[model samples]
Target chain A: MPTIVVDVMPKAELLDPQGKAVTGALNRLSSSRESGSGISEVRIGKRFELTVEGPVTEELRERVREIAADILSNSVIEDVVNIDFGDDAS
Target chain B: MTFRIGVVTFPGSLDERDAQRAIRLAGAEAVELWHGEHDLKGVDAIVLPGGFSYGDYLRAGAIAAVSPIMSEVIDAAGTGMPVLGICNGFQMLVEAHLLPGGLIRNAHQQFIRRDQGLRVENADTAWTNEFATGDEIIIPLKNGDGGYIADAETLKRVEGEGRVAFRYTGLNPNGSLNDIAGLTNERGNVVGLMPHPEHAVEAGFGPDTEVAMRSGVDGLRFFTSALRALAAV
Candidate 1:
């Protein structure tokens, strides 16, 4: 079984309200998006790990990317989900 | 016919009920779906609710994206069925490649939670048709890994095309590029946002009930929008 990890990223200028809310409270309300953080943009994403039994090869990687692209994502807003397939596992 | 929408539940999903409630509150039927199930139950729209699907074990919605139910979701979204992904659901959309970009950990390195302000950037999507452009809405936003990332070129394209659906207001909670709270595809049917809209569909129970009735039913519009879209079709 080969362990796999997948990551999802968002586009720029898409305000991550959750992310901004946190930055505002950081340092006990010292700075934030409201205070004019002067930060024009932010990015957000998630990581996934999967255990699979497969050979580690370019074909396998493409297959995994295809899985991430078609069955795993919405292709429009998301750029590309990176899949990390680990070495073959017993 | 009344619009029917499906709420997908992965093994570790936490917002299935919330999503169902939001759907029902919007005057649409809510269909419960499981990750292992391959049927859509004739839903007109689909909601990938927020939660720690697959225990967030594999990058939030990574595993759930490949679940049996997702096969149907892919099929439905392709035919122009309205699909909305919230928070973890948003992550799954990105992982599933239905949307662009990915979500990462906050730069502050912590699970952030709060009532969030959002400026509706695009009101044309099936899920957002009820809203108007630049409308400000408040919803509960909570997540650990909600930072959105994408290559520079992709970022430019998403913005240049006016695909951005929502932008954070008041504060940049996470280190997301351009403060993007949500986005829609070119056709404006599929939408993915990092906020927990499900949590705001109820009254005092939601984060932003100060303005409306105790129902805190503002979020219901998301579902109703889809229902109206289906009806128009």
Candidate 2:
């Protein structure tokens, strides 16, 4: 079995409040330490692992790409950042 | 003939009953439809009520947008069927590409519930023919992810075309761009908004008015507007 990894993230121009809240929490924790961590910003996203049987092929990759772009992510406010096929790369 | 409006109930839907009740109060037949079904049951109009469908998984309304019944919804909307989406239903509309733009997490990062004020921007749509442009109304709004966003070109085009159905009057609750609260499609048959209009249809259960508490029936016109639109056809 091969696994196709799809990563989706909010658009860069759009504001991400969830990511901002996480960044704020990290900054507050780092401020208490003697050596402050250099954290500028953070953006949270989603990763989907799709398991498929059989060998990876160009046709299958294209099909997965279509699903990633259309079903897995909405192009209006989010982008499909990466699609990775591990070990079974064609 | 009595107008029959369908209210779709998806898995985890919380406001389908309220929507059906609102339609009935407007002197129309309220038809119950399911997300997993393939039929619209010969409904004259459709209402997508608010709720956390699919538990808001994989983004709100994302999964439910592609459910079995949505294919029929998309087709019906294409042929000029009147459809209204409220709150989470609005999310599904945008997710299904029935309307433009997208809704994201609120800028304040908190779930907000309020009696929101809205100014009618376009009164010619199927769902808003009862209103006049610039008419202000109050409706109850509740949501966690309701911030509306779009690219520059898309925003400009939507605004230039007079597709904006409503605008937040007093305050932008979720930091929606341009204070846009609702929108209508090009054909003026489909509309989506982030407020719960069904909650405001009953005089005793709606937002407070100047005369009495929870005595506002502004939402009743939304259902009547659909009836009016259907009668003219």
Candidate 3:
């Protein structure tokens, strides 16, 4: 079985309010949870790393992209598919 | 004896320098440690600073958790050496199974930068010995993979044992359950927090204060606390 890997980011174009909310939340939770702390989770975009085994070809790459956009990544708010691998997909 | 702190330099680690500076500010000798190197050079404590190790290529610090140097770091931590991991470093500590839980991406999907606050809940850990039981402090925070996730049992045990060090006060940044900001092992030797305390060490460069941002250097206490713990032994 041929193996391929794909990495993605939160399409730079979309605004990620979740990131903002969390950053702020980390600070609050830090103190609120405590009888005193308020540090929150650091802000960062979403990403996924997937490994699939099949034909390592351009056609397969395109098919994977379609699946990601349709299901894995929401194109309406998130930009998906910044990488590919099948012949030059690295 | 003067404390020797080793700062690991994993490929793509952005905050190692800041950690090193924090070490020096705390009166400890800072040692540069390579992620690929297996030898630890006998440092008293180790720090895994934040940043994209291997460009977050394989699950944020996933690949890095298995680096050669971890063998020593893990062994040391097991033997009660002070091991502190920042943002990416905290991710690595989890991936290595040194600590519990996992770090996921921000649910919002954006890179966030802010002056964050944290309460010192467990001041008994080696890295936090200098802090009071209820002290609150602010530090700079930035990252893209900061969500902290764990099962209910683990969270309960952590609370029972007082392993939950710092907690988020006002908000829940990454949907982390129980609002945990930092944690320590049962022995209280290892610590992993999401904020960058090192960045808040020097005045005019750290977090903002009521009078002026970054004018206070309370964050330096983290490093000093670690050194103090090792010395007490």
Candidate 4:
């Protein structure tokens, strides 16, 4: 079995308020520490892991890419990255 | 012949009945359509009302975009059938690639409900022909993920072609680029907007009007415009 993983996130140019809010929360938590706001940026996104029985062929890879680009990610506001297949799949 | 307007009701849909009623108020026959149904009931036009479709899972309107009924909607829109997407329905349209751009969470990151003012930017569309290009109207707007975004080139193209159907007047409710509130396809049939026009179609029940004791029934123009478009055909 081969496991395919896809990660989607908002585009770099777009404002990600959700991610910003999380980063703000992180800053508030670390304000008392000596670390002193070590984090600079944070981005939130979605990941999908798919396991398919049998071998991972080139055709299957292409099909997964197509679906990832067309359905999993919206080109207008989000980008699809971290598309990889795990070799250790049972 | 009475124009048959189909109002699609998906799971979690909250405004399909309101859209149907608006269509009826416009003197058109309101037809109820289901998302799981493959047929559109031979409707002359279609309205995808707003709500948190699929519980806003994965993304708003992402699941409903590929639902069974959407295939028929895409086909009908391609053939110039009038299709209007409101709020969450607008999200589904963008997800389905029937309209340009995508809607994301508001800049303020909170659900907002208000009487929004909009200016008619393009009146030649099937859904906006009843208004003059510069006419300003008020309608109810309520949503969380209503901020609209698109690439520079695409925005320029839509703006250049006068495909921008409506623009938020006075204030940008959700930080939409260029104050855009609604858009139409190249053929002027498919339209999508973040506001709930169906909510403003009836008097007394709609938003308050500035004219004192009047209802914000400006949204009636959208449905009436659809009928006018059909009449010209």
Each model's DockQ score: 0.11, 0.89, 0.09, 0.83
Candidate 2 residues lying further than 4 Å off, grouped into runs, are: A34-36, A87-90
Instruction: Give a tens-digit lDDT track for model 2, residues B64-174.
Output: 999999999999999999999999999999999999999999999999998889999999999999999999999898999899999999999999999999998887899
lDDT of 3 by residue, B1-233 (tens): 78899999999999999999999988999999998988999899999999999898746777788789988899999999999999999888887778887676775666778887788999999999999988988877788877676666777788898988898777767656677888888899989988888998999888888878568677799999998998899
Query: How would the candidate models be sorted by TM-score, starting from the highest?
Result: 2, 4, 1, 3
Quote the chain B TM-score of every prediction.
0.95, 0.99, 0.97, 0.98
Local accuracy of candidate 4 as per-residue lDDT tens digits, B1-233: 88899999999999999999999999999999999999998999999999998999878999999999999999999999999999999999999988898898998889999999999999999999999999999999999998888999999998999989999998788889899998899999999999999988888888888874438899999999999998998
Query: DockQ of candidate 4?
Result: 0.83
Worst 10 residues of 4 chain B by lDDT: B205-214
Worst 10 residues of 1 chain B by lDDT: B208-217
Pairs clashing within candidate 4: none
Candidates in descending DockQ order: 2, 4, 1, 3
Clashing pairs in 2: none
Could you tally the backbone clashes for each prediction? 69, 0, 41, 0
Q: What's the i-RMS for candidate 2 in angstroms? A: 0.6
The alpha-carbon lDDT assigned to residue B201 of candidate 2 equals: 91
lDDT for position B213 in model 4? 47
TM-score between predicted and true chain B, model 4: 0.98
Q: Please report, in order, the local distance difference test score of every candidate based on alpha carbons.
A: 0.79, 0.93, 0.79, 0.91
**Candidate 3, residues A1-90: lDDT per residue as tens digits?**
544444445535333445566677666766645453344334344455556666556687777777565444433234554555535535
What's the CA error at residue B89 for candidate 3, in Å? 0.6
TM-score of chain A of each: 0.61, 0.87, 0.52, 0.86
All candidates' TM-scores?
Answer: 0.75, 0.97, 0.74, 0.95
TM-score, candidate number 1: 0.75
- Top-scoring candidate (lDDT): 2
